[model samples]
Target: MADENAVIVNVLDLPIEWRHNITPYHEVRDPDLVQQLRASMEAHGWQGPPLVCDRDLYEVNQDQAYTGSHRIVAWALAQDDPSADMPCVFIQDIGEHYSIDLGELVEENFGNTYAAVEQFVALLPSDVAEAYGLDNG
Candidate 1:
């Protein structure tokens, strides 16, 4: 579950100099997947927010993306309209949270990364989910 205490912030409202500090554990985003995400945003707009760490955690003023770098990029590319806000969950103390080990949960639930992706993709809109070859069922 998403943290109830998360501070919602518009992605574009973040400091211009603040970089997206992606963790080493995160997979390198596939270009094809990014394109699909861009297309999805263009067609139906962003569905959910990404998890980002507070800027105070970094000495260089970087915002750590706990998840959703692709979505952020796709949002910016699909629409640069200032009024289009991408409300992201900005967590202040992610280290203190118990929900960080997604790998363990994913392995327990689906037994593999590919299955986990499909399962999550199914949560999106019907058409978007179908594009990824997964049904809501």
Candidate 2:
């Protein structure tokens, strides 16, 4: 059960304070990211909670927000009777609040996959090395 005090608002009613921070991550590869998500949502409904963190806890000067926030807001915007409200979870207290470094999270998520590629290359048989311009010697 969720706490009665835990704030849950419609996707439309979300104020600037709650949403001004969230950042959306989109890729050119995701051609229908905006369309598909909204379409599926119309048929069904939102299955996930907004990724929120305490505002008063950490003071990040140059910070970015959690990924996919725009989509959540967009989904709200497309509704016929859109309220644009969404849940905003906050840490209870200044001392007890927990949040992660957004920069680190982004770096981790978007880190280069060179290591994986190297591993795949290492697995290739030496017999094919000459064919692929490799000299295992």
Candidate 3:
């Protein structure tokens, strides 16, 4: 909903003041995804930390609580696994200002059958939606 797309800033770029752990959003991964990611990691090693943020991660927008949490939890769980310790980069203080385009968000969630962009967008502030030219209603 934020006008500007979620800027993929370097993990190192975030402010020190923003660091905080609200805990990862837990989910029982589908066996297939776990297997697939496991295989990918075996061959490539942990690519990088999953994009994440602290409790106050949202800026112009809100609701990473629902959409962005899983991405972090999956990476954390993977890292904990004895087999594949994928080192994940946990982000802090991100939100509408950090959000990428709706299409980009959808693409990031590619494997999922349903579109969460609309749902996330719905949770964004009115100003955020308007910024993205999405709050037509």
Candidate 4:
């Protein structure tokens, strides 16, 4: 389970190896989407903090992202210094039994939105959905 508490951490403080897509095969390469995200971050700043799981809890060497790959990417792209630390929320108390069905959770939380649905449909295949028990059919 993830700890309800969140904390501020620097983007650069995050381990490079752990910066991975939360949803498998959901790498967003769309320049337009990236641009839009960058613009949003530039204008309003990071509204939602990225969710990170503690690697030590999972016996891993580095912390991993549970969500917010796009935001991290946008922060990297929008900043004058990519390594500069920006305020972010890090999820604490993630244990070894923590579920990897993050994609489904994100979709379930935001699936009604067009962008969320588009991204979910674009990246998540039926097989993966089934594996995560997120398949509608």
Top TM-score prediction, candidate number: 1
The Cα local distance difference test for each model comes to 0.45, 0.37, 0.39, 0.42
By summed lDDT, the worst window of 10 consecutive residues in model 4 runs over 88-97
Question: Candidate 3: where are CA atoms >4 Å away?
Answer: 1-23, 55-92, 96-137
Report model 3's TM-score to 2 decimal places.
0.34
Q: Return whichever of 2 and 3 wins on lDDT.
A: 3
lDDT of 2 at 105: 36
Clashes of each: 0, 9, 9, 0
Scored by Cα lDDT, where does model 1 land? 0.45
Clash pairs for candidate 4: none
The alpha-carbon lDDT assigned to residue 84 of candidate 4 equals 32
- Per-model C-alpha RMSD: 10.9, 15.1, 12.4, 12.1
Q: TM-score ranking from best to worst? A: 1, 4, 2, 3
Q: Supply candidate 2's per-residue lDDT for 8.
A: 35
Q: Give me the displacement of residue 52 in model 2, in angstroms.
A: 2.7
lDDT of 2 by residue, 12-83 (tens): 223323333433322334546667767765665544444333353236532222234444555564454344
The true-versus-predicted C-alpha distance at residue 42 of model 1, in Å, is: 1.6
> Lowest summed-lDDT stretch of 10 residues in model 2?
91-100
